[model samples]
Target: MTEQRFSRRRLIAVSGAALAVPAVARAQDVPAAAPLHRRNTMSFVPQNWQDHFDGLGIAAIVADTTSRALHFWSGDGETYKVYPTSVPRTDELTKRGYTEIVRKRVGPDWTPTPNMLKEDPTLEYMPPGPGNPLGTHAMYLSWPAYLIHGTHDTRKIGRQSSSGCIGLYNHMVEELFAMAPVGTQVRII
Candidate 1:
């Protein structure tokens, strides 16, 4: 056999090209518009406060049930925030329309609503603690038993898991709690 010399650089180049050929071919084989299965995950579409509120009076919050998101705008209209949230479990439990933040509490206690007790008698009054459903902070709406609060269970966020309240992650609620003052206009759609 004739003596053959192969440089390391040439060998590396050849090997790299060989490896890349399959990847390039595979990429081309994929269809440009392949259908993808839908997922149950948090995906926020940017919302304009003007569309939902007349003005950002003391701040404005819109809890969108279909998108499972909460949008906030500061009173001066300088700051805007979007947070993934857990909506009411069902339409029957959902209270849509306008309301305002009537009260705010840090470490809020949980008293099961009369309707809630009727549904599940086991739900007792839970004091503010680890077990409390209304996580670290709560902003009570004008509507009774309806609140936008944090949840201890992280899994509840971005799902239909609340009895009637809008649920946010504990840290997110704490942030929102600080931003939205009492009398902040709220719209649940």
Candidate 2:
């Protein structure tokens, strides 16, 4: 009876430790909001916008609204990275156009736009932190109030959840912010 009790306790402890390993590994895979310059070389052939950007020698971003995916292309025309993103939620906010990065901010505070405030009057300014809607970093677009920003709610990625801005996972946005400088061309389709 003593030997069986000891074995059961040992097994429970071992099982708990085993369950912890994958959690630790997953945590390590997420990049912190630091200046990390790692390149993501995942490739996908552009379905709709390839002809528009083929042979273009400038670093650019292309967002596919249908797939809710963002593709970053290097100067060489190869996809540097691909990340799941959240796009505009409503038809009025969803439109395709050309834009450029107007500004970049690290841990940016979010002020609700006029439209947002109209929709939710109680919404107010959000200071930078985990609770902030604009998580970690943001790259504002020249297109008025639109932006490519990180989100605290990572589950929103790969869905249409934002008013108009593009939302990436916090870790992915950190990597993208490091790669995309201001004035980088962005084309949404």
Candidate 3:
């Protein structure tokens, strides 16, 4: 596919506008910057993922349609997923079971990539395969390129290992697909 370049100024404007195009309350997953010393390790295990899932206080699942299931749930600093979905937080509230109001659109040209990818170029722009943290699936949050998805590596699932993106297992993500609609409520704990 042909690539289009969005000027930084334009990107900033567009991102800002994107915030308004989709109406929503502030996302729950946004967290204060962590201490530079590191609070905990980042992992992509089912147990950790589950803990994060349950942490959202069971309000609504800000589901990550991506293969990586990290953003599958929302929580506090312990498991914060960035760019939370702007859609409704519950199926009971609307006809649409779930919907992502602002999914970060990523093509060949994207700006301000995740910290992990920025720190490690080998990981970013990698082809689909082992070590590709993007995994086989990626359901993006409203934040650009930030997603709740699967991972090629399972060890990094639960912790804050991504560049503001949620990570999960490919198989687990397939299961997540059956759970709801495109507009489902996604509440980051």
* Candidate that would win on lDDT: 1
What are the Cα lDDT values of the candidates? 0.93, 0.82, 0.44
lDDT of 1 at 32: 68
lDDT of 1 by residue, 53-143 (tens): 8788899999998889999999998888999999999999999999999999999999998898899999999999999999999999999
TM-score of each: 0.81, 0.72, 0.41
In candidate 3, stretches whose alpha carbon ends up further than 4 angstroms from where it belongs are 1-118, 121-124
How does candidate 1 fare on TM-score?
0.81
Worst lDDT 10-window in candidate 1? 34-43
Ranking by lDDT: 1, 2, 3
Question: Which one wins on TM-score?
Answer: 1
Predicted structure 3: lDDT: 0.44
lDDT of 3 by residue, 1-189 (tens): 999898999999999989966444443333557444433333222323444333344223543323222253332334333222222223331221233523321121223456545666655355555555555655565445545556666656543344455445666654554342344345443
In candidate 2, what residue range of length 10 has the lowest lDDT sum?
40-49
List model 2 lDDT by residue over 73-157, tens digit each.
Answer: 7766555678888888977898687887889999999899998999999999989998999999999999888899999997788
**lDDT score, residue 132, model 3?**
57
| True lDDT of residue 37, candidate 2 | 46
